[model samples]
Target: MSDKMKKGQGPADEEQNAQWVASRSLMNVGSLDESGYLNSFYRQGYNLSKCLSESFANAKDAGADKIVFEDTESYNRIIDNGRGMSRDDFKSMFSFQKPNHSDRKSCGISGIGGKIAQCILSNKKTSTTYTFNGDEYLVANAPWDRMFEYGVFSDMITIDNMNQYQIDMFNARTNGNTGTIIEFPRNDDVIDVIKQNFSRNNKDDKQSKMECVYNPCDMINVVFGGFRLDISYKRRDGEVEQMQMYDYFGEESEKYYDGKTTRTIEHYYDARKDISRYILKADDVQDESDMEIPRVGRGYSKDPRKVSAPYEGYIKKGEYVAVVGQRHYTDMDEEPPETIIQCYDDRKKCFYDEQFEEGISDHRAPLYRNGQMIGKFHCSDVKYTNSRANSKSYHEIKSVQLKLSYSTHCTQDNLLDKCMGIQQNKNQFQSEDMPVNLTRLLGYIKKDKATMIYKYFESIRTQPISPSQPSEVEQPVSPSQPVELRQSVEDSMTQRSVNGYVTGPLTPIQVTIALGINIGDLTLETLTRLGKDRHIIAMFNAVNK
Candidate 1:
């Protein structure tokens, strides 16, 4: 026997000695209430996909390149090519209610992901976890039923030398390298729940089942690069079907033509205020179209007159521009629904926009923190609904989707901080402060620019064109027509003089008509002095009319 094995040997054998030491250490060091800790997770809410996502996140944190999920006749296994756990790590994993690992940037900040998953999977049954390190291995056997019966966590858990079957399973999955393998008795209910939860169709209806079949490959695609998850299952015909991470989800293709238009606003950290502020503004861009129309002056007048000035057709660009597209959920024959104006805040990862349908409240955006969606906000002025599939009252906007996103630093804004303070279940934020902040922020958005752009395109689509006259139609004019045409031109000029305002710089004829004098009587100095005087210009325009 090797020196290490010989040294570990006791009365019965090395294997028996290892088991005793493991059990003793667990009892001596593990000081936590397993049942209470697990109950807390249940109270918080247990999502099957979230549990699995936590496991995958852990694997990524460990720098694992490959992960596998296999269903055997007796057990279901999840194996990963991650750095195997040390003795301390193995113990710490089960030490419930612990904080997150300080070094890892993991989403499982509570450090209960693996424990919750394992306990739920075992469900009072026996489960095994093996961790391999070089030539040595550690095994943890969890007999949950026995532990619950004894009311002591250490009584049900045993740390021992790995058995041959476990060694074989580990070798086959990790190619005999250092890694971790978890196994539990095959439970169809758990497997079905996982399949249903991770399915893409559950994006909108997370709580209930839909007609779509579960595709593990697509699920992997949705959460790609974080970790690799593969599933191996047997078909009814006795053939094994294996699925690996694919490059695209089913909805990705649909987004190609009907994706949301996005604009990003970056803010640098400010040291003075100890917060970052992103100022949202839209820039004006000249329209490229060659078509020209008359430019109308602002406000109303009883006698409106067109000047020599033409419309420049300048349009607002940058963040001020809003996306105008057909509704994603309309049929071909049906008229396209109204444009939806969506605003997404990237920092908070929340959206604020008008609701599609009428409900009790006008809330339409879902709030999120640390990637997990919490709840909705219903401030009177700026209400938002939870975006989760389980929300009982979801609001939809039929027309004008306006999406906007705020930076993470903006959450620290006084108004937002107060609103977020009263959040429940991280799900809903209720405070008058929310509406106050939202109203202030939205004031910067130029809705008139979006409306002008929408109208410009709408006119092109609806305007009717008159047919051209045929070449065979001959035209002739009498001599008297030329004299009448000149008389009409003079009459039109006289009418314009009656209605036009003499403001700013004016031509000789304009000044002559405005002052009711001949052109020869007007001097450059006189015209400049009269143009600058609002009272004189107004009186001259009124007298001419």
Candidate 2:
């Protein structure tokens, strides 16, 4: 053949050579430095619990009923009896922020939860994944450190066999079951970083840390944040030992629940088009008094002329029902000053109380979407201005802690589906899409329920003396007595002094003065007799000038 003809080569040979070059280039792309993308996109709130929760969620999604968290001398392992990933799934695991499966019922919607967990918890460049697929056990070694350093997804290695060490551990722990084991080499740095980020300095942070505890044996009655977490493991000698993880809240004060109220709200609204709707079923058991569940469609109406008319545009517009019950803990003697409202999804994933800061103007009743708490809302349907004191939204959320359970049925075709504004984290409802009319209805329900609760407690407080006991008589105060004596007698009858300071019973004039206004017309005695109601306090401040 001529020299030119030989150099040109056969068409088949040229195509093969080009294909090889393209394959090499794809490999190079896999190995490129991904640190920028990882840092910018994947570095979410890096807490140990978040990492562990994600791991648990992954296990649960994979159909794992039993999970074991073991810390060994060489590495930390999260072993689960879930169906192990296939080769394709194993490779797809490294894809950033992209989930292979989108199951609405699962806690891990974004597939990056595990990746984020692993990146934040592992110090080394590699993590070992061992999965069994019936006939053979497969091992995939992910070079995550190298991926972060070189910025490529191609450094991972997979094989059909495990090293002697892995085999031994698998035999000892899983007894050769078909499952998945994720191993991260012991890294104190990762642990330290997690602790630093999750330090319990605030109420929300403390609550978040508490929400991470999981018990594999009892999935239904899992406690969120608590004083103790029991972990069971086999000792070197083969005896099983149970250990506890303690001091989860550090220095934060622990809350005790004396009463609980479980409420179920089921509502649906159709405004020509399906405007907004919900079907809620909750069991509240946290209050000392009996709950008076309002009539669903008809009882909420206020018009005397239309007594039978459904509470206009409220629960009447749709098919709604709620069953509420309250119970006080018999062990507790006195009511707790502050009530605790804990919100959980159907999956038992706890929504942190902090999520309520947004959208919930007063944080009275936390909002829920498909069982996960989106946020909290004011008890009343009023908005407030800084100078106006009370535009109706100002109420202490802690006064009545309630577990509001409901589910949203917003399909792809529903208007609510178009407006359902859930955040990527699934922790909050976007305020822009929050249905005001629905919220107002809920607020009305909670407010009325809370009023009844207060009234019940007030009745208890003002119970008349038993007929068996002799009633005490009060002598009238003489006007001739010294001003201080007369004032002191009246104060003793209405208010009590704790230490040297008078506690309450502030009069309108006193409220005005307390609100930084000089009430020139009223006497100090009259001002001192006013009750410390929030509305009165607000009115005092508003009209003080």
Candidate 3:
């Protein structure tokens, strides 16, 4: 071959060349032994359930509520899938100090050992995961396991008799095919997530559960692939319906779940367009075609995230929440994943600080209190970017800007308009055809209001009373003192007395004024034009003067 041809890459040479280039990094330093790889899972902190709940919460907010919410049978299996650390995936999902997982590949990798993504909810609430994996593989990282066992995964002891989802999954994956079964025995603490966000179904059974607890590999897919996912909670009775879908790792999902299957991008975008209604519409997105869901195939086609939450912002509009700061690179590194949460703050008249977060492993879409973060943005999976960690060459950081808008309960930026609990203008106050969106807005509000209403009456029940109870019809007091006992009578007397003082139309206040000219010469019509609050006050003061 000529020198020009030799210098350029051939298909075969490029493959070897790419590996050589990848090997230059520290990722190629040394591979981990099998035992060392298993030790990584031991480092995952307690409160795995809390992390699972946040994943569900975030997924629900972005309109995936329907596809993921589950019952105990399906939820547990998904949890197993997320917590799973097979010999194939990373040696440790949370930490970067893996012996087997090297920086040879250009994929994102982290070595600093911390699990902000999986352990955040522990500070917020207690967590529990119920699965049918015979508890043998039902790994748990609870409080007692931690104080005594250190930062190791405390495996649960179990009998195979209680396994329901496992049996179902085994049936589905009979022979060579492989499938998973997960169940959620209880209502997740993050029910507000779906209540505030998305839904897939109301009362459907028999269909297999669609969500997993979100293990680190899944985290890799979600963080590196831009995958919108969530952890689901399913139960036996129809109590926990299949209303929402996917466990979100907040913004850095599409980077991780960008799996390569026998799927065409053109077909994927086409199907996304056809099912645009099933997909979601956001305001920030202008060219809907430009919004490409990188990976597709097998799942998500039968069920996808629901467009059930209201769009962000009051009708006035302007402030927007868009995803920015991409940490995923095609090259290898030992850096952690991080991103920015950009939103306009009208009061500050500018954007919030250039914030760097560990990144969300789940969606709690900018948790709001009267529409603001109570303390600080909960950053998950955060690590600083570095070009030096793996000693690889040609490292670059690019901020991927996305036209952002939510596809649930509302829409903006050319996406589809979502359905809120309120009826549309056409339907006009009729809830008949109107679908009740997720419970985030009015549901949570109504629940709080209902609690308050109940407590008010309950307080009345607990109040002190006379030992003798009055009969329903019998008089409790004599006619004279009865007036005090008759609440309605006292109210009527007061209203009647006020009515005597003010019965007719509001009486116009009579005032004599010297408008610097003369009130005597001024006509009512002339006075109307000059009537300002200040002028009126001046006229009244002048009259008094």
The model with the greatest TM-score is 2
lDDT of 3 by residue, 370-455 (tens): 11121112112212243123211001111111112222212121112222121111011122222222112222222222233234
Question: Which sections of candidate 3 miss by over 4 Å?
Answer: 1-50, 53-69, 73-85, 88-91, 94-233, 238-545
Every candidate's lDDT? 0.43, 0.44, 0.27
State how far residue 544 of model 2 sits from its true place (Å). Answer: 35
Q: Write the per-residue lDDT of candidate 2 for residues 1-545, one digit (tens) a residue.
A: 54643565423457775675676564544543455656643445445545665565567656676666665667777787877777777776766556555534444444566776776667535777788756566787767777666665544555557778777777676777777888888766544423332232222565545543232111111111221223344322444444322211122222212122334444445565444444333334333222222334633222111123243464322222322222332223443211111110011111332322222113344444433334444433444342123211122123334434344342233333234454444334455555544444455455545455544543343332122322232332334545565455445423322111344555554433333334553432332332222333233333332
Local accuracy of candidate 1 as per-residue lDDT tens digits, 286-397: 3222211122253222221222333133221112122222222322232211111111100111111111111211223323333322333332232233322211112122
Q: Which 10 residues in a row give candidate 3 its minimum summed lDDT? A: 338-347
Candidates by TM-score, descending order: 2, 1, 3
Report the candidate with higher lDDT, 1 versus 3.
1
TM match of model 1 to true structure: 0.46
How far out, in Å, is residue 169 in model 1?
1.1
* CA RMSD, predictions in order: 21.5, 14.4, 24.2
